[model samples]
Target: MTDLERDHSEPPDCLSIVSQVTNSTRAGKRERLAGAAVRVLHEQGVEKTTLADIARAADVPVGNVYYYFKTKDQLIEAAIEAHGHHLQTMLDELGRLAEPQDRLKALLRGWIGERDLTAQYGCPTGTLASELDKRDDGLDRAIAKVMGRLLAWVEEQFAAMGRTDAKELAVALFASYQGVALLTNTFRDPDLMATEGARLERWIDSLT
Candidate 1:
């Protein structure tokens, strides 16, 4: 599939793993597993994380996982898909703001949850792609779509601001985010995330 097609496409659900989340007839164990997988994948690199770890985190029997996911790869793929769902929710919420500047600020504001958690784990949406890229195994593309769409959304905000280099601005803005996240995670300094978030908000205000 083309890059555009890939971006627009719904990632494989790994046998409807997500749909099962809302099926009241079931115990919602699948939802818990998917949520736990996201948490495990974020807190630990994909290469080091095991299905057993995820099972333990979800409090599901290790053997039960195979009923939902035949392999760890399927679980990971589904977890990455779950991230897309989460990112869309953020975008939808940010869309509620009226002005482009407010929408952009809202985007940054959305990142301010559980500071020490972010300091310890880094930005979940951004860091997962970075972690997978380390493997060079080509699985990073799934997560990269989420990042691409995020940058595209930010670029739209800058373009609305009449910035000719809107795309470049988007790149720089996102780079600042990742850089701050790296520093926060490295130093375990929760303040770094807040400080950088404030700086970005002010910088947005400074734009002509």
Candidate 2:
């Protein structure tokens, strides 16, 4: 038998060519599956999404999906992780801003701009959190963890402004902005964000 066939006949080993191929295939499938989830989650709320939907969206067999993700919750967690990484990259860029308030303002403005792009589609994690509430505790926790990172970053910025209760202030700011975006989306009026955002900018200016 050839060396390749000999390696395959042997017991499981990390260095085996067959093992390497299996790992590569698994990784590629995961990447495609994650991409499908992102697209569907952005276009449709989690409540409206299903494993079959993801499988079809990914152009993979339904049973094939089980080979990679044992449960829908696992897929959702992976999608959330991908989004968290993306948001972290955005935060890293914003962190480079010299002024604290400037960093905060840029962060807020960037979020609003992103919402405008998907105003019709709705926020990814926001929609998932709303739909998965009480339905899947694990998914709820995952979404909360991602949102907590954003909240923590905001609080850090407020603390830089010398606020004694930075966490509370950050929560208030997030609440206000979420309300504005929710109202804007509900009314189908994009200007609501721009108008209210300017007011928020003025308020932040007064802080320093």
User: Which portions of model 2 show Cα errors greater than 4 Å?
Assistant: 1-27
TM of each candidate vs. truth: 0.84, 0.81
Residue 63 miss distance in model 2 (angstroms): 2.9
lDDT of 1 by residue, 24-125 (tens): 544566667888999998999788898899999999899988877777877887888888888888888888887988988888886755568788888887
The sequence of per-residue lDDT tens digits that candidate 2 reaches over residues 27-146 is 455657777898788777777888889989888888887766777888887788878888899899999998889998997787678667435665666666667776835788888888
Q: Which candidate leads the pack in lDDT?
A: 1
Worst 10 residues of 1 by lDDT: 4-13
Model 1, C-alpha of 195: deviation from truth (Å): 1.5
User: Candidate 1: where are CA atoms >4 Å away?
Assistant: 1-26
lDDT of 1 at 38: 93
Error of 1 at 101 (Å): 0.7
User: How well does model 1 score by local distance difference test?
Assistant: 0.81
**CA lDDT of 182 in candidate 2?**
69
